[model samples]
Target: MSLILEEISVKREHSFRSKIDVLPHIEVPWHYHPEYELIFIEKSHGTLVVGDCIDHFNDGDMIFIGPNTPHIMKNDDLFYSKESEERVIAWVVHFKEDSFGKEFFLLPEMKRIKEMLINSFKGIRIDGSTKYKIIQLLQNLHNSDYSQRIIILLQILQLIAQSEDLEYLASDSFVESFKQSSNQKLYKIYEYVSENFQQKIDLDEAAKVANMSKTAFCRFFKSKTQKTFSEFLNEMRINYAQKLLAEGKLTVAQIAYECGFNSPSYFNKQFKANTGKTPLQKKEHSY
Candidate 1:
């Protein structure tokens, strides 16, 4: 059984008109579009998978994804809490390439904007004072007419182009392939691992999630994620451990157990191997 991932479709509606989708949760499968995407996640928390990068995103986080990039926003399970009817509000502005025209960016007047788009391949996170301005712009775009909306998008892009607080999120391995298909098996495998990485996960259990035989699952998982199942699980555990260590409250041994390592000695060895530093060393460096 193959894993099923969400696929996002890119639509080219009009030449100059951009589309803004506001939704609780975009249920699109793992897919990419040709146009550039500016997403403002207002009130949501989840593990964001962008290209080859996976990281957690909290409320008020805004990201600019380049054209043809594969990404998804997986909401936290807490979103199902009944007390919160307020859905995940996100403003996704999708615009075609050269929507502003080819000559528009080439002009000396738009050099900075051009440079910013070039840097967007790594993905950019909006921060600090620029956050509110961009948010307001996105809100306004939702109400504006087509021409005005285009202008607002250009303004937002220009602001991102000029902001210094933006940070890139993905690696160079995030090249576009556009070969995504439904991976129900893979999603099940990832879901299980993500939920159980804090405990010992046997290959038998993981393979069972995909309903595959152990040997076949091993080869298939490695082919999809480019890492062995055990390696991926270890990396996830180490990432969680790193977060705990950064908080500076957990003892090394405590963190080791909390992150699912059977013993501190084994945890220390794995930590050093994965991070090139001991747990204490990581904590000190963080400080």
Candidate 2:
């Protein structure tokens, strides 16, 4: 995957950009853009990394991201398999501070939204009733004329500003210190791990991918992602395993091997450690 500094395309007739993405998988690697973003996932489940916060995202998940915050969503491994029919569907809006005019957001009447936008520098996940409302508004946004879309966009921001269902995804320290210079190397490591996690991974090779010593790479990865390389790898494997278990097309042992675990016993141990449930138990719960 190439290092991406995404450029959001807004048409000359439009002040901001909005669109729906329907794909077999999310292809954007670790990247950032100048525009703030609001994304609502209509269908999907996967690992999402926003700054230093790593978490699982499911259908109906939504988040707002401030300008220049690096983020990525890697669909579960099954989505990448040719035999899997899974799809990812989402609505995304991208706008800049000048979307409404340079000083529009600086006006006294825009204080609440200005504060919310500032807080979004760390990335924000919308939850509860607010999420549903925004999703609906995004739908309306897609069907509206330019004037109406702009109105709906402001309404969406207003709802988010007034609601209590917001959780910041990245940490204060990360937002304070992050710069684009480090992303190319870090994106290499992430892309490498995502592509190779279904087999043995060599620490030396991973370090070389980041152009660093093994010890230094380990520390840098942990500092950026807030998880050890091993932990991140295991989490990726477990995430795929969970998806397979939910599908009920394979035995637990089959899933273990498919997800790169050498022994079912070891897979069971790790599954429970990560999710507090054995593979079989998780399968049962899925049904």
Best lDDT goes to which candidate? Answer: 2
TM-score of each predicted structure versus truth: 0.66, 0.69
lDDT of 1 by residue, 76-105 (tens): 766656665547767677665577676778
**How far out, in Å, is residue 14 in model 2?**
1.2
Candidate 2, residue 36: the lDDT equals 95
Q: Which stretches of candidate 2 lie over 4 Å from their true place?
A: 179-287
- In model 2, residue pairs whose N, Cα or C atoms come closer than 3 Å (at least 3 residues apart or on different chains), thus clashing, are none
- How many clashing pairs in candidate 2? 0
Could you tally the backbone clashes for each prediction?
11, 0
Worst 10-residue lDDT window for candidate 1 reads 173-182
CA-lDDT, candidates in order: 0.72, 0.85
Candidate 2 lDDT tens digits, 47-162: 88776566678998999999977788999999999999999999999999998899999999999999999889889999999999888898899999869988999999999999
